[model samples]
Target: MKFNKFSKCLQIGLIAIPSAFAMSLTYAQDAGTRVAVVNSEKVFNESNLAKAMQTRLQNEFTKRQNDLRDSAEKIKTAAEKLDRDSAVMNEAERVRRQRELADQDRELQRKQREFTEDLNQRTFEERAKIAEKANLVLRQIAEQRKLDVIMQEAAFVSPKADITDDVIKALNSQK
Candidate 1:
């Protein structure tokens, strides 16, 4: 019984392999289908549009970042002062100062959180814009080259099939 089952499996595998190979050969021989690959990470990091957007975001957030730095320094100074003077102050005075320091620290943390959230949201928005523009450029290239498929991400792409440089040039040329 085991020998019969093994023979049947071997026959099925032998039939399937040739059928799959023939189908692949037929597909490969077709001249109408053209494929291309694009390095999206390279485009995003090296393109003029992406660089300009990064600069704009940096400028927009620079002031807030500096302010956060200043607030952190102030908090540090207050902490040090409290530590240094706590021994000489009355219990009530020490407690009040500690409470004030805690409040300031919380407020600073809240502000820092808000700043980080805002920066992340803005970065996401900017990335979306860049992706939209890149897609447009990619479609244009695909049409111009008569490509049936243009993959943005691939495990491996040959230099002949990579249209990343062309995409970057097109994006940079646009307003």
Candidate 2:
């Protein structure tokens, strides 16, 4: 009984493999011949538009970032002073200073969290803008060259199939 089951399974597997291959061949024949690949990392790094956007974002956020740094420094200074002077104070004065330090530390932490969230949100927005612009250029290149498909970050794309330079050129031309 086991041998019969094994034979049946082997036959089914053999039939299915051939059928799958035939279907794939038919689909390949119907598909367009032109294909292209894009290196997304290269596009992001080399594009003039990306560079300009990064610079703009950095400038826009620099003041807030500096403020955060200043606040952090102030908190550090306060903590250091509390550590140095606590031993010299009376119990009530020491406790009061500790409480004040804790409050200041909590406030700084809250501000730091807010700063991080805002920075991350703005960075994402700027990156999305750069990606959208790069995609537009990619589409333009694909359409101009009659590409059936354009894959990004393929593991093994041939140099001939890489259209990243064209997309970067298109982006730079807009500048």
13-87 per-residue lDDT for model 1 (tens digits): 999999999998788668567889998889878999889988999999999999999999998998999999999
| Model 2, C-alpha of 138: deviation from truth (Å) | 1.4
Please give the TM-score that candidate 1 achieves against the real structure.
Answer: 0.79
Give residue 133's error in model 2 in angstroms: 2.2
| Number of clashing pairs per prediction, in order | 0, 0
lDDT of 2 by residue, 48-159 (tens): 8778877887898889889878888887897898789888889999888788878877887898898789878987887788789888988888888888789988879889
Candidate 2, pairs of clashing residues: none
As for candidate 1, its clashing pairs are none
lDDT of each: 0.93, 0.85
TM-score: which candidate is best? 1
